[model samples]
Structures are given as C-alpha cells and as structure tokens.
Target: MIGYMYILQCSDGSYYTGSTKDLERRLQQHQSGDGANHTKKRQPVTLVYYEKYDRIDTAFYREKQVQGWSRAKKEVLIRGEVDELHRLSECQNDTHWLERYSSAFGCAQASNIIKKERKKDN
Candidate 1:
C-alpha cells in the first residue's frame, strides 16, 4: 500500500513530521487534536510538504529521519531546495570532515577534494 510522509506547520509555527497510510484521515485527526501530543497542543496544522512511498515502513522511516532535522534544514526541504539541503547537511564545526580533508589541500582546493571524496565512497 502507498504511504505518505508529511510535514505540517502548527498553529504556533512549529513543524510536525509524521507518516500515515491515509493522509486525509490522519490530517483530520491532527486537526481535531487526536494526533501526536505535540500536534494536539499546537492544533490547526497545515500540510506543508509530503512525499509518497511504496511502503508504509519507508514513509515511517522518512518521518523519523526528518523529525531530527533542524528547523532551517526542514524549511529548506519544504522549499524543495536540494542544494541548500546538502549544504546544510554538512557539519559546520571546526572538526568537520571537509575541514580535515581540505587542511592539506587548502580552502581553494576544497571543492576538488570534496569531489574526489564523493568519487571514493559513492
């Protein structure tokens, strides 16, 4: 059966991620405060984004994955900005892999190093 992974904007401006086999019914539950506790308290949700999956498990997995994302990351995803999503997915800390790999190559050569790194693993 087809499943849906969806993101909803709550009344207080928070985002809720969830998966359901019947999107319309699930949405109605959320709207009626009969859904997740988070959404129940922050009712009047609006569907902002969703993805369809062939299996319910896949949709549930996607829901779980997106639930851990930062608000900015979620926003970019909702906006359908794939490039921004990848850029934001990278760690910004000093010990980031990019920094470690680029240390020897220098910042100017980081893109080339990144390309090589992608080729090596993926």
Candidate 2:
C-alpha cells in the first residue's frame, strides 16, 4: 500500500509530524479532533508538507527522522530547499549547526547563515 509522511502546522504555530496510509482520511480525522492527542488539542491544523513512499514502514521511518529535526531544518524541507539541508545539517561535536547557531546568536542570525549559504550556492 502507498503511505505518506506529513507535517501539519497547528493553530498554535507549532508543527505536528505524522504518517498515514490514507492522507485524506487522516487529515479529516485530525480536523475532527479524532487524531493524535497533540493534534486533538491543536485542532484545525493545515497540511504543510508531505512525502510519499512505496511502503508504510518507509513513510513511518521518514516521519521519525523528520520528528527529530529542528524547526529550521523542517522549514528547509518544507520550502523544498534541498540544497540548504546539507548546509544546515552540518554537525560538530554531535551538535547540529542550527542548534548551535540558534543558541549562540538567535534564529535571526541563523536565518542570516541560511541566506549566506544560499548566496554561496548561487
């Protein structure tokens, strides 16, 4: 069966990641507050991103991988900035660049880094 890994932008401006075999039905469930507990509390979520996979397990695995990602990384994926992913994922001492950059300066500074990287790519 086909499967899909998805991301939802919640009413609270937070993100919720999930996987489903039936995207439409699952989205309806979430909208009706019959979804995950997290989505239940943050109803009326908008589907922000998704990836289709050949197997449900593959989609589930991808969901798990994305769930561990920082918001910046997820945003890059959501925006389809595939090139930025490697730049943002650069790690040192087991700490992701975004995590370190964010803690060091701030999200705005991190955004600057992304911009700089984009310029370099171009």
Candidate 3:
C-alpha cells in the first residue's frame, strides 16, 4: 500500500511531521484534534507539504528524518528545494570533525601521549 509523509504548519507557527497510510483520514484526525499529542495541543494545523512513498516504512522513516531536521532544513524541503536539501543536510561541528580526523589518522591515543610529553617537557 502507498503511504505518505506530511508536514503540518501548526497554529502556533511550529511544524509537525508525520506519516500515514491513509493521508485523508490522518489529516482529518489531525484537524479534529484526534491525532498526535503534539498536534492535538497545537490544533488547527495546515498541511504545508507531503510526499508519497511506495512503502509505509519508507514514509515513516522520512517522517522521523524530517522531525529531526532544523526549521530551515524543513522549509527547504517544504518549498521543494531539492538541491538545497543536500546542502542543508551537511552539519559542520568541531567534535564530529575531530572524531573523523582522529579515526582517519589513528590519533585518538596520540592526543593523550602528546599531553604527557608536553608535561614532561615542562
């Protein structure tokens, strides 16, 4: 059965992401405040974006992925900015970069050794 991943713009301006096998029924449930707790409290949500998938699992996976995204990344997806999605998905952080660098160069233990050597030198 086909499934859908949808994004709703809530009454309070926040976004909610969800997946359903029956889009119409699920949307009605959200509108009637019988949906998720998050949407129930933020009622009167507007369907901002949706994507169809071949399998329920795929739709559900997409829903979870979208839920973890930043508002700007979600907006990029909602606006159908396909090209920008790749760019938005890239997360640059010092810790992650350092971990990657350390793993690549086998420097995970080198840091401790360098610290010890510096102490000895002092």
Each prediction's whole-model lDDT (CA): 0.92, 0.91, 0.88
Q: Summarize candidate 3's per-residue lDDT along 69-117 as a digit string, tens digits.
A: 9999999998999889998786555455556557766576646655575
Spell out the clash pairs found in candidate 1.
none
- Could you tell me the TM-score of candidate 1? 0.79
lDDT of 1 by residue, 13-51 (tens): 999999999999999999999999999999799999999
TM-score of 2: 0.75
- Order of candidate numbers by TM-score, starting with the best: 1, 2, 3
Model 3 spans with C-alpha error above 4 angstroms: 95-122
Ten-residue stretch with the least lDDT total in model 3? 91-100
Q: Which pairs of residues collide in model 3?
A: none
TM-score for all models, in order of appearance: 0.79, 0.75, 0.74
Poorly placed runs, candidate 1 (over 4 Å): 97-122
